[model samples]
Each structure stands twice: as C-alpha cells, then as structure tokens.
Target: MSHSTAFASQADLAEKKTSFTQLSANAWAYTAEGDPNSGVIVGDDSVMVIDATATPVMAAALVRRIREVTDLPIRHVVLTHYHAVRVLGAAGFVPEGAVNVIASRATRDLIVERGAEDMASEIGRFPRLFQAQESIPGLTWPTLVFEKELTLHLGSLEVRLLHLGAGHTSGDSIAWIPSQGIVFSGDLVEFNAGVYTGDAHLAAWPDTLDRLAALQPQQLVPGRGPALRTPADSLSAIAYTRDWVQTLLQCARDGVAAGHTLQQVYADTRRVMDPVFGQVFIYEHCIPFDVSRAYDEARGIANPRIWTDVRDREMWAAIQS
Candidate 1:
C-alpha cells in the first residue's frame, strides 16, 4: 500500500513550527500548528504545566520556552486526560523539580489500565508528534488524583482543576484560572482542527462542552490549536468543537438507524464531513477513528474499546478497503 493509503498519521513526519505565546500575565500557551498544546501557569512562587507533550524530548522544548520567561521551578504538572500524546512527558518535568503530577482519578485509572497499549498505538499512528519515542520511559501516573474538582494555589495564583464531564475521555478535565478568566481545555475543545473522537464519550461530550462554555472564559488554550486571546474566540472554539462532535454523531446515528454496516457508516460519514472539515488539520487522520467510535456509541457501546496497534491496523483496513 502507498504511504497515503496506510493508517492515519502513519507517514506524517514533517516538522511543525512551535509557538509559545503568553495568554495572560501568568498564563502561557505552547502550541504547535495543530499538534497537542501545553498550557503554562506562572504563579507567585512556582510554575504549573498543563498537558505534558508526547515524550520527554518534546517536552524539553516546552520547558525551554517556560524558562525563557521565568526561572521558578515547575512544581506541578497536570494531565487533562490519559492519552499518551498528552501525558507521557511527565518524565521531562521531573528534572526541573519535584513535580506533583495531577489528574482526575478516572484518568489515573485509565493510565494504569491502557497506558501501554495507547503509547504503542499513538507512536505508530503519529510519528511526527512523538519526536523521540525512546525518550518516553513509561506510562505517566499522576501522583495527585482528584475525583470531581481540586483547587490549588501556586503562591497567590489560584488554579481550579475541574472534571466537568466526559468528552474526549471519561476523565476529561480543564484547568481554570478564574482570576485570569483563562481556561486550559484539554481535548474538549479543538480550534480549527478536526476532533479526535477515537476514545471519546460522544453522547456525553456535548453536555460537557456546555459546562465548559458556562465558565465564560476570556482566554482559552485548546488542546490542539492556537490559544484564543479573546472571549469571542474562546466561545467560537467551543462552538466549533460542539458542531464537529454533533455532526459526526448525527452521521453515525443516521447510519445505525438505517441499519448500515461500519464500513458503510464510515463511508457516509466521510462523504458528508469531508467536504466540510477536509481542510482542517488531521481531518483525514481523525475521520476513521472518530467514525468508528461514533458508530460504536450509536450502536450502544458505552465504553470506548481499547485501541491497540493491532486493532488500529485492523480497523483502518476494514474501513479503507
């Protein structure tokens, strides 16, 4: 098979430019051109990092960016979810200081359950994102786990971590800086990028998004795109993510209602969503995974199936063949 015909993101090895922009006086965003983003919060004494990069090597770049502005130790690291691409970089933060890795209890459970399988799957799928796979020592386990919400203070800065509901994953959480009116929405909101719903809770995602929007953030750092600097852009990102999820789920629902096979459902979904979201980042790469999850949800699959590397290839072949 040609490289293009292979599994999603398999051959995408080109480098992307990284942007580290300050969102507020204390909050910053390290965004690549649609790759996973990390949010930085500089408090009065120390620093907190949200969403570590894919590997320790990749995360070193984020640390360098953080050092460009502040020399305070990175005392806290927060995992918004259990995806390897987002959390495996916790190792990188250790060198800076005694990092207190934090996550929702559900996320920690997921990491313990499927973190290995996910690491292999993600590395195989997105080579460019994981710059140095060997640098990843092992699964990232959070030292600090919370149930619904946790509040912390980095000196005078107040950071509220809340698990609104399930969207990207069962443990999806967002870092809210209430005083700054800034929110670091993990994968719950993607701006101008295709949503990756492979491990998503499609049915509950919208309501989770509703709760996220209710916070009325003035600035928002999305998981995969540039940081939104204004309240208008922040709200628009939420709307965009909501529409994408709704559209994909609706297509899956329609296919299931008409008694279509998975392949047929994928085809129908691509036919409609491609024209609209085809130009977005990772559009082609995400559709197969997104449709599969959506179809399973439409057919009453409550929990997302574990996506191993073998399963990834099998599913890709089933849909692409």
Candidate 2:
C-alpha cells in the first residue's frame, strides 16, 4: 500500500470500538490500541485479571468491561511479567491489602531495579495507554511471589500460574486454568502483534514455547492479539511467536558473525522482518530497539543492560537517524 493508503488503514483500525473477546465459557481477553494485555477469568465467587494494562484510567475501563461480563469481585490481579504497562495499573483491580497480586520472583527483582526507567520508556512509546500518569502512585508490587509455579483455588475454581522459564522476559508466567482449558500466555505468544523480543532470551524462548505447546491449551489469551479458541489456533500462536524469535536470533547471530555494528544489524533486521511482522502494533517503535537488544545477546551479553531515560533517547536518535 502507498504511504497515504497505509495511514488511512491505520486510522480505520484506531477508530474501531474496544470490546472484550471471550474465548471460552468464562475467560475474557481485552484489546485496546495499548500496551500489554488484560485478561479476565471469572470463577465461582471471584475474578482474576491478568496483566493490568498501563495505568489506573486504562484499567478502570477494563474493570468496566469486567463488570459487564460478571459481577464477581476481582479477588486477584496477576502479573504475567514485570513490564510497567502490565503491572502499574494493578491498583485498579483492588487495593494493596484487599487483593492478592501475583508475580514471579525474578520479575519482582526486575521491577525494583528497572521499574522507573521502564515505566518512563513504555509511557513514552504508548501515550494513549497510560492515560493518567499522575493517577499511578508508583510501581505496583506483587503481593504474592512465586518461584516457578503456583496453584490457587479461588472459591471453587483452580488457577495455575507457571513460570515456564526465561523467554520474553526472565520472569514470564503463563496462567493456566486446566479445568477450563484456558491458558493466559502473556506476551509470550503473539498473534498478529509483533513478538517484542527486547528483554528476551533468544535461545530459551523456543523451549518455553515447547512447554506451552505441551500443555495443549484449548483456549489461549495471547498478550496482544485476538483470543485463540481451538487447539490449532493456540498452537499456531505459539509457533508464529517461536518462528519470529528464532528469525531475529539467527539474523542477529549472522550479522554479529559478519562483524556488523548494531546499526547495520538493525537495518538488516528491518530489511528482513518488515515483510512478515512490520505492520503490527508498535512495529516502528519496537523493531530497531529489538534488533539492538538481540544483537547484544548474540554477542554473549547476558542480563539486559538497564534502559535508562537518557539511554532511550540516545538509542532512538541513533536508530531513527
């Protein structure tokens, strides 16, 4: 499409209405033109929402949707990862002491160390998502921390949260409701949305997908796309995410082996990935930084370097210019 045509297409997409996509009997997925995802799992007596979007105002809107679905008190708010957009709006679910917020231990550590900078970066990227910054007091800390896995019974419902290993982030968790056969694979499985492998473990992501596939979820709520209803759809989601991560990893490895600078690798990545994933959400804002981070990992760099505000501006200017 021409540039003007593409702009019109995006404008149409943005002007669409926001509604909940129900995958299974009581499982719900939320999609706005925003950061991260919000999932609502309604149980017997209460509801558990996964990933709180970006801020309170955004989350309040999600809450309104949940109220539309079921009147169950949102007893628990779960954090699938430590991203600012996902966890900061947790207060919108319930107050600190009243509701149990869950997250992986590594994610908790990441929030403490890099939370502020990440919050700043993501808000800068997706302004509409973080509707009211001042409404956010600070970072939302998880009240309950799990190492690898934890199972909880909310009244009569069974909710399983598993840390499948390092993939999208060091502390990614997949919430599975086996009885309902619905798995909330946050950011780990992208559908039409881009696979955002910035703080990712390139080599480990596939293994995590392998684990996700083994579970054979009948319904999947992906981080940023439409809900997957059948087993085929679920597997396809995981496969596409795996393929995207591996493609970037191999590209970065090849570029590094050829002694390419970060800029050269970024250019090559866009040259390659644009044909497949270039039109997804935040593709322009995310791809170059994703390439740079993957390049750093390919060069044997471990533990993502902290992305401070100044560093973000410097990186964006370097990549965009």
Candidate 3:
C-alpha cells in the first residue's frame, strides 16, 4: 500500500488513529491522544483485560466501567509488554484471586531489571494517567508467565495469547479473542502514532506485523490508535507502523554514515518522517528518545542499554533543550 492510502500524511493518520473507538459486544479500547492504549474483553463468566493503564487510579476507572457493564468477575489480566505504564496499574484490578495475570517470561525479567526506571520515565511523560501516584504500591508482577504461545479458555470464552515475535519490545505479546474476532495488537502494531521505538526491534517489526495480520482478525485494538473496524483499515495501520520503523532505521544510518551527531540524526529523521508523523500523539515526547535508540541499533548496538535515573535526566535535559 502506498503511504498515502494508509495515511493522508503521517500527521493525519496519527491523529485519526490515536483516537479510541468501541469495537464490538462487551469489548472496549482505551487509547490516548495518539498515546499508548489498552483493551478490554468481558466474557460470560469472567472478564479478560488486555492491559492495565498507567496507575492504580487509572485502572480503577476501568474497573468501574466493567462494573457498570457487567457484574461478571475479571478473570485474567494480560500484559502486552512490560512497559511500566501498561502493567503498573494491575494492583487496581484486584478483582479476586481467580484472575490470572499473564505475561511473557522476558517481560517478567524486564520487571526485575529496568521496570522501575521505565516507570519513572513514563510517569514524567504521561502525568494524567499516573494520577494518585501513591496509590501505585509497586511494579506489577505477572501471576502466570508463559513463553511463545498459550491458548487460554477464560471460562467459555476462548482467548489466545501469542508471543508473535518482538516488534515493540523483546517480550511483546498480543491478545487475540477469536470469539469476538478482535485482536489486541499491543505495541506490535501502532495505529496512527509514531511507534515508540525505545524498546523496539525495528528490523523485526514488519514480520511481527505480518504474523499479527495472518490472524485474520475482523476487529483490532491497536496499542496506540483507534479500533480498526475494517480489513483495509487494519492493513493500513500495520503498514504505517512498519513504514515508520524502516524510515527511522534508514534515516539513522544515513546520518551516521555522514558523520552526524545524535541531534543531527534526529533532525534528519524528523525532516523526512515528520511530514508523515509530525501530528501523532507524543510525537515530540517520543522522537528524541526514539531516534537515539534507532541510531544506536543502526550502529550495531544490540541489547538495549539500561536507562538509569541519571541517564534519564541527562537524556531529558539534552533532548528537551
């Protein structure tokens, strides 16, 4: 698909995709203004939540929504990845012991290592979701961890959790509800927003998207965009995310080959990708960090380095200035 068919421009696609829309019966998506989003699927006997919002307080609001719709218990909480904003609010979803919190093994390892640093970094990025910060007891740990793929029957409702290769993060997973014909694509496929590539695998992103597309989902709740209602729309969203990763990878390499500084590389990426992404949610919030990571990866840096408190502040100061 041509870039424009998927997007009028990056800005137009980002804005339209980031806005959330309801998908189907008992299914809902909570998206940002082009920021990260979570999904929910309520079953007959229990509820399966796609992701926990940024804080306990934010998660409480979702629980309230669930109560308003159905008294059925929330049976499982699925973490798409190990991002602090996505998994931290799990404490708010203390809906009973029956609920199985599931994540990839790598996600569990991430929680052990850099979850705290990421928590601080994201809190500073998104203040609205992290309201009642003290309400967050600590990082959320998955009760049930899996490797690769798992077929979970949440009561009569059949849900599929697949670790369909890494695109967003090393441990990225997607929640697929075949009964509803809907898939929660986590950050593996960003609808309209610029993919936050700090923890992303740019080279593998396309194939990951292809694996997700092969699922033949009729409705899709992308990690950051609106719910995709049509096949064409879904393809477009996935394609755009792939294009974004490729664009940044090429731009970073080009800048480095020309002996440019990190800032210079970022500027070059912006010049080309901006026309397509200038309007996405957190475009400004994400670009410097995204560029830095991409630059490092393009220059042969494997296994992303830890971002400590000092490193976070230093990057924030340098990038923001």
Candidate 4:
C-alpha cells in the first residue's frame, strides 16, 4: 500500500463565504458553502438556534447574521447530535441569554462518554472548521434532554424536536415546524454533499430517512449544503441521502460476504460511490471514515468505535495507504 496524507481534510484550509437565507417568515438558514450549517427560528419574543457552529468565534458571526434580520433574543441552542463541530459553539450564544441547550437523551450520553476525545479528533482532522479552537470553553452539554420527542412554543410558533431513530449518530434529531411545513434536519440529511457516516448507524439510516421524508416538509434546512426550499428539493435531499447510505452499506456487505479485508472493502466501496458522489463537498475527506463504519456494521459491529486523533490516523493509514 502506498502512504498518503493522514487525512484529506488536513489541507482543506480555504474559507467559504457564508449565506444566511430566510426559508420562511420566521425560519432562516446560515450556511457556509458545504460547512456545517445552523438554523435560526425567530418567534414573537425570542429565537431558537439549531446546531451552533464549530466555535464561539464562528457562532458570533451567525449571531450577527441573526441580528441583521431580527433583534429577538437567542434563547435556545439545539444540538442535532453530539458532534464537536455542531455543539462546541454553545457558549457563543450565552451572551444572547441562551438559557437552554437541548438535545436527545442519547446525545447527552454520547457527549458525556466521548465528547473530549471527539473534540480532539475532529479538531485535528479538520483544523479549518474550528476557526477559534481555543474559544471552545469545554464540552457543550444539554440543559434539556428528551427521550423521543419534545415540543416547544417560541411565542406562538410551535417547534417539534424529534429523535426519529438514528442515522448520522445514535441520537440524531430534527426540528420540525409543522405549521410552516419546515424541518431542520441535522446530519440525518445532506443535499449534494458527503454524508459523514463516521459515527453513523448504516443499517438503520435508510429507515430513519424514510421517516424524515414522510413528514412532507415543504422547506428543509439540512446539516450541510444549501437549504432546501421547495418540497421537491426536500424530497430529493432525503432520497439522495437514502440512496447514498444504502449503496455504501450494500457494497460493504458484499465485500464482507466475499471475505474481503477492510482495505479491499474500502476500495470496492469507493469505486462504487465515487462516480456518483466524488465531486460533492468533503467527499474525499469522508469516504475513509464512512467506509470503515459501514464495513464494521456489515460485519456485525452495531456501534461505531470512538475516534481519537490516533485512531483517525491509523484508520486513514489502513484504508488510504
């Protein structure tokens, strides 16, 4: 095997221009090209932010964008999952009276169990994403935890926080605004961008996507990529993610059944998926991790291994080299 860069993302230092688009009268999406996106919902008296950016400094810019549209206080910060890039920016919202950081019970547990290790691993893998790494106070824990679903009323607007099974992570959740037919799907759905299945439940992801599509959301703010404004776009995003996950897992399962090693499986899966998704954002950065997890699941590993900086390098070496 030939040695390659430990992580493809190590060289991804270029900055992306941010866009803040209003999806509805009250909901807005703050996206930076294909970087992790944040969703903001303005209510009668306050605001609720879904998925804080990677750092406090980065999140401050999101707050500034929100201020440009409304002066409402940012009262809530929601973590779609326990990923470091999404939750580490909770502190940035404190100055805006961010009283509640909400997440599913499983997300809270994952944070307690591996948040520190994940923080280090993610920062090392994608340094460009964590702009002000020092600004992250510590692990961002949730103030409120729910089992399956929790509904909140931001003034008169109703927001439904639901854990519709697992895909990107065991505790993946989405914010659904029923009245407006809008859903803020975390990493559970990505449009024309690579899906990071590093910690994903590959076998269960397709079903979770089915549930998300059944919502019939007219507008959706995905975890990455541009916001899906039309119902057709929303449905397309769900179908695209579903196909990606299913295809990857099928390749892994076929490789395992044929007794291929991890590296071979990775290569085979890449050959199948690259033509379809290689040009998508972060596709190269995510493939090694995605295929590794898919291979594990196909071989009967129900849970993903914890990723540290050391493990990330080892995995990359094993697969890439």
Model 1 lDDT tens row, 1-321: 121466788777778899989988899999989999999999999999999999999889899999999999999999999999999888998999899999999999898889899998998898888888899899988999999999999899999999999999999999999998999999999998879999999989999999999999999999988899999999999999999999999999999999999999988887888778888988889989999999999999999999999999999999888
Per candidate, the number of residue pairs that clash is 0, 0, 3, 0
lDDT of 4 at 121: 97
TM-score of each: 0.98, 0.92, 0.89, 0.98
Q: Report the number of backbone clashes for model 1.
A: 0
lDDT of 3 by residue, 1-321 (tens): 111211112233232222334677767787766556888787667788889887888788778767777788877899999988788888888844466789999888888888888887767655555668888998898999999988977567788899988788889999888877788988888876768888877777788888888988788878886778887888888888888888988998898899888877876788898888887765665676788788888888876766655675576556444
For each candidate in the order shown, give its overall lDDT on alpha carbons.
0.92, 0.81, 0.78, 0.92
lDDT of 3 at 93: 81
**What local lDDT does model 3 show for residue 287?**
74
Q: Write the residue-wise lDDT of candidate 4 on 1-321 in tens digits.
A: 232465759888899999999888999999989999999999998899999889999999998999999998899899999999999999999988746999999999999989999999999999999998999999998999999999999999999999999899999999999999999999999998999999999989999988998999999999999999899999999989999999999999999999999999988887889889988999888889999999999999998999999999998888876
RMSD of each: 1.6, 3.3, 5.7, 1.3
lDDT for model 3 = 0.78
Residues forming the 10-long window of minimal summed lDDT in candidate 3: 1-10
Give the clashing residue pairs of candidate 1, or none. none
Once model 2 is optimally superposed onto the true structure by TM-score, how far is the C-alpha of residue 269 displaced, in angstroms?
A: 1.4
Weakest 10 consecutive residues of candidate 4 by summed lDDT: 1-10
